[model samples]
Target: MLQSRLFMNLKGIGISFVPRYFFQINLSKIFNEILKYNTKELEEIQVRVRYYNKINQFFTPTEKEKIGKFPFKKTSYAFDAYEISKYFKDKFLWNKDFNDVKWTFKDPTICKSRPLENNKNNILLKLDKNRHFCFLKDDLIFENKKDIAVFRGAVYQTHRKEFFHSYFNKTFCNIGDTSKEASQYRKNFLSKKEQMGYKFIISLEGNDVASNLKWAMSSNSLVLAPKMTCETWFMEGALKPNYHFALIDNENLAQVIDHFRTYPKEAQEIIHNAHKYIKQFLDKKKEFHIGILVLAKYFYYSKQLDLNELGYEREILELIK
Candidate 1:
């Protein structure tokens, strides 16, 4: 229900972002306009509008990722990556890959040594899209929260996990096991809002820069995280050390905790700074803009697409570059 409503509201925003120079009236526009009117309420919508000689794929996230399709085992990481391919696409093109889509809201595959683009300044940072986007609850009690940290997820594969309660006393942290049943696991899960009941939260690197890092940034808790070898949409050029999340090590976690406990003001300040930065930086509005820009670049640089036809698309790509 929430998604249905947001999809409808977002179309107007999408339309306003498009300039009038892209199309002059024609039979296609007439039909497109009629189709738009007929399907007033829907799970999603797909429409293409042309202005002059230029064309834009409306409802399209990016042309790069949408270009190919392949199958894998049930437990494959591609299973999740495959679902993400639907981020933006015409419902009818569900079978297709997001072609010329050089990037996405979050790529499941990235590491620090190998950056996406050669130019650091020109690299486009995207926000990790929450498939279950919803309004976060606001009833959390910030003042009377737990002093210890909490972690609840798959053991996933990563080293330097001494911070996961192995090195810390259980009184100060709780890194639970992974094999609980769905309902029971959910029962133990610390929700985005409920996590406010903690003074400290450990942000360890999972298969990628842990998604929890972003939530931790928005929360009122101090994030104790090590330098991430795996990068994500928000990590590359966005986060800073000692500002967004504290730099911790596999050893001496007790000392790290003691230091923060001694200087509580500094810990609070770090949390406050990260909260402010992420709140402003990862706004949903900007996420939408970045998604579109990625598509524009894929079209502009892709040899697969006829480059001549995408001449006007270069304007948007230029700004992104």
Candidate 2:
């Protein structure tokens, strides 16, 4: 206990140390049992499981060596992957060193990728999980909040800058650039609770997928977002425009807002659908199952783990079917 506390304090000061046994959970037996039970709940978990880990190759040792190993403690982003890898009793080549890169990996590697770049090899995991996976509680109903839409975030990306330049002055929207570099466009930062006061919240992609998307969808307010160029464990690609969020670009921001404001029932439907989409992520037990399954599939395909070692390879085949 003393050693653990000391290590934590050292981590707080930017000195990082990861004890080898920290990620070993001995939960594979329990996980296998969960997989053995074929039910509606497990079916839902498998959908997300398939979405995260798409590797379907049998890589030789030589090919796996060429992919190169990424340092685990290089960043907090890599930490999630490192911890998960050890959870399954092995490690593999992975990259959590960068974000929003538009290239796909040729050899099997466990990493995140843009939606368009997502192929069988670029295995996705919930890296940087805290920043990307938050959900907010909202009590305000759509009919009761201010009708104006709100957008407050750093304005560095080309698309973000374009949206700010075009719609920041619009009457129906309250938008601001929060980056120091975008001082001229910057406005006071609005907390998540503060942003929920308005009826619509803009979710724009930054670096990769929009980090705000999960919470924005969880809120009572409707989300205003363009077509997603990237995706994560949230599976942004599956979201239907006009159903989950009102699709908006600079040209149609006002028009879409006007239509939704005038027809609140329609806006309420979008909110309902958004809430439905958010429900899948709310179950912590199923989420753990899905994460384990994703890693299981990843390791299995890469030839790291044997068929019997997963304890339910047949069950995985059936669940995936």
Candidate 3:
């Protein structure tokens, strides 16, 4: 009778019914049977259970140092500038002013010849001794020299090959703008790169988080997942598209790619598997429903109980039903 009541309650909740006898069996007895002769089975079961639990855990604050050492130096410098601006305001302001002055002065006098007596020997010497030094103007006065040094220091501090590549090489695609012109442009750009034998990866951005992730799965390419620091609306926008590459934010691209490259081989294989799964399941209604169901399970599990928190669970359940 108790088993029947439980099954009836589950059915009323729209869950499919299972045989009542399955629930009637003592769970403790089953567990003991599984562990009877296998001492290692308990440890293996614990590891898997813990792993699944961890996967459902809500986002916890983690120190960068705790995440493991990164393989590549950070590729983005924008955050470095932001960090410096925050803690060293005065120094940052001074550097900014110096950069403005140096660029304002040096750009106009790049090709002008000087008199033999006033040849740029001193400037050449400074350049030779310190590659960072450059003359802002011919006079090389204290103000000019100070400006040049400050600007040069900032430039040198920001210079990193990975940083430049992340900023310029990664492309951002917008699904809303996938007109004929945009399609042709992307086709041509990709063709040119292919012709040159340059490898590339694609990412998609959408208006819904799950949708954005779904699009990433569709691409079969490595993704640079968005950070929580980005605007929520923009993140949502990135997730709404069904068939687009993951759209990497300019600032986060370098960090994400670096993270992926440094990931353990097992992790990399899992990511590759996810990509393949996405590709194989794309446009399949049954798979889409399954994805939603899996997402709901994680969402509810993260909240520590079976109750729905996001309303997405109810929405998806309705759709699936």
Candidate 4:
């Protein structure tokens, strides 16, 4: 009992000494310890953030992520304890009684069934993640775009590969890698500066969901992607199709391009709205603040927490307010 109090006090003292990024990186580890060991009297349990790098790859027992390791970096997580707990129940926790505990929950290329299928138990908190960094430029204009659309990196699945290849590396389609039979497509990698300059950024479902959309929206360019049935922490349910991105219907790429090109003013409006939305809510500080609420909600549902036990008590209250 005395040792637990000491641990909590040590955590309290140390939290103030570190930068938020330090906490963001280590919160998962810290919280995992609490989740595993601290069930006695719940007080300010550290809510954590992480994601899987393995994606679809199976890990051996040793290679598998340790309990509580949510493996993303660069950006922090707004921990969705409710959704995360559901994951735990399905993949790890086996107690049928946990069904009464209740919970809920992204990505393409790495495919999975439609996201939010069990949203009845899922609780969404806020959006947060890390991606390519580029300086925001006020001078960037639609005309600065070098191509109609630009996509880099590899695509999995035979059909998806063929779709990019059929474009034949010209005009509307300039894929980066040549190995895929878009042999004519440019082989040179597009730098971040060049990607930001383009008028339309292409986001496709890879693995499970596209990670590019968040950062793409951060840039001045307009995002073009299909209506994503898969989801992430902040996308899908949170984002309206036309509001957050220009729709790219299946096999209707040409028509979509013509519409956006002919009516650029409309495209610009969507771009403006997207930029404003991502920038306003997704900044770093708020990212951690949102993470705390996710943890709060999980505890609210599964384990009652005394107000004094919370680490970010003020932030959690602000959610209900």
Candidate 5:
């Protein structure tokens, strides 16, 4: 995560520290006007918009008073939220917390949580995007890489510490902790490129979601992780076990690794499925549209926007059908 922060700060410096969110917020209105979704495109957006914001009740004008906007402290999180909320502009409500927001509001509220199954009010946007949304180019194919599984990250959770102890000394595992307070493992930082040399890359859940999961999937190596507990815009819930990733737990990690090592074809297929899942997120225009539409639904349900003012009436109609 330290690496990601430095990269973004350098990137911000390159662009004179202009908030990219501010530009996107302004351009969103124009794009919303000019962009026309065909039936299929609208349908896709409808599915995602509904998934993000499941508010079914229309708040009365009186009921809308309960809604509240939250001021986020982190600049990156605030900027990301503004990119969508600026459309509604102080109209919609959001969770006040950050880093795996766990609270649920009585009224519909936007949030950036792991999207637990029952947390319907937590309307997810791709917040802390620079840290979570990384994709890489892999020149090494699965067959050419070493047969070992590698993991390199901060040990924030007890499960992470257990994982480090479980396989750190194994011949087939190369794992380390990046946190400063960590003991002997503190010196074992592996670069992203270095981890690519192995056939499997471990992606354990940190504070919420696995930050490395995106780039790990993009690599030639297969992603090795347990079932995802939380998800962001990448929709970890939609991913299939043993298809998009090699699902493993503390008990089955080595067995799963050995199975993949013996059956390289299956590993390649899982990598293929991961790449397919990733392809949808690469379309910048569609992603922007989906973000706007998700917030539009938020405003409508909160009664901040009148029914007639939604602008996506045709799309909404088709969505209901």
Candidate 6:
């Protein structure tokens, strides 16, 4: 859970710094736009418009109305970075509340550091060998329990060769559409998969889509992580609905052996150091304990039982009192 004081402090810092960054970048664009429209004929037109009408009337009706309704609207969209920064100043950043902060996760395998374009075939081969994991391809067969399906980012025909080689399951993750089309696309895909006796899963990329994906999964099939790991700020107060699983790689044979060899010294020390830092900053005694209590209450009230009943609650409460 996030403490109010900590939230306020972080919000203040972000509000102060982020706008400055935005403004510096936007200012250059504004200057470029001004230069592009700096011709004599454009200057004459501007002068005539300014003289014939009030300075505000030079703007389109919609723009004028927006300016009138929200005085900062013009500055908010100002091209220059500095002006843009000024526009955002002191405005409560929209997502200050954790209730408004969305959570999501993404497929780490699909989001590997290597460029997919350069290694698509190799990736496909790897998927074929590791048949338990899902692979994104078109023309996926909806057969066997061991196979999980995924949608290819590009054309179906191009992915057919890989699809032919793999076992098929009904569950899949899609990546092609923007948010506007996502709901519809998901519906259609689920319907098709259902017809073929398969279930579907959705993996998303950002906070914007996380809540929607959660809702979809609660009603339909499973929902995978909607955002990448790096996007999440773990301090946020709210926990996403527990229907979604956090997918992590279970240790392989090599990892198991390495852990045993390293556990007594370096690995254990590193883990201890991480815990100490977390305790110092995030879990400092009673204050942190209170935050957890408050979060438990909120989850109980929200009917989010999974969070309320997660295994740590008892141990956390024991520490709190």
TM-score to true structure, per model:
0.57, 0.86, 0.23, 0.58, 0.84, 0.21
How far does residue 29 in candidate 3 sit from its true spot (Å)? 5.3
Per residue, candidate 5 scores C-alpha lDDT tens digits across 52-103 of 7777776533334322243435756766666555555444444334557545
- The runs of at least 3 residues in candidate 5 whose Cα sits more than 4 Å from the true structure, single-residue gaps closed, are 1-35, 60-72, 91-96, 102-106, 310-321
* lDDT at 2, model 4: 53
Order of candidate numbers by TM-score, starting with the best: 2, 5, 4, 1, 3, 6
Q: Which stretches of candidate 2 lie over 4 Å from their true place?
A: 1-27, 36-38, 61-74, 90-98, 309-311
Looking at model 3, report the run of 10 residues with the lowest lDDT sum.
146-155
- In candidate 4, where is summed lDDT lowest over 10 consecutive residues? 93-102
User: Per-residue lDDT of 247-267 in model 6, one digit per residue for the tens?
Assistant: 212122233223424342432
lDDT of each: 0.45, 0.72, 0.26, 0.48, 0.73, 0.26
Residue 17 lDDT (model 3):
32
Best model per TM-score:
2
Per-residue lDDT of model 1, residues 164-230, tens digit only: 4355335566665453543222325555665657777777765545657766666767888877654
On residues 150-237, what C-alpha lDDT tens digit does candidate 3 reach at each position?
A: 0000111122222333453233321112224422112222221121121113333222122233333323233334332111111122
Q: Which candidate would rank higher by lDDT, 4 or 5?
A: 5
Judge candidate 5 against the unseen true structure and give its global Cα lDDT, from 0 to 1: 0.73
lDDT of 4 by residue, 10-63 (tens): 544454344434444444444444344334312322222212111222212222
Model 3, residue 116: what's the lDDT? 19
RMSD of 4: 12.4
2 against 6, candidate with superior TM-score: 2
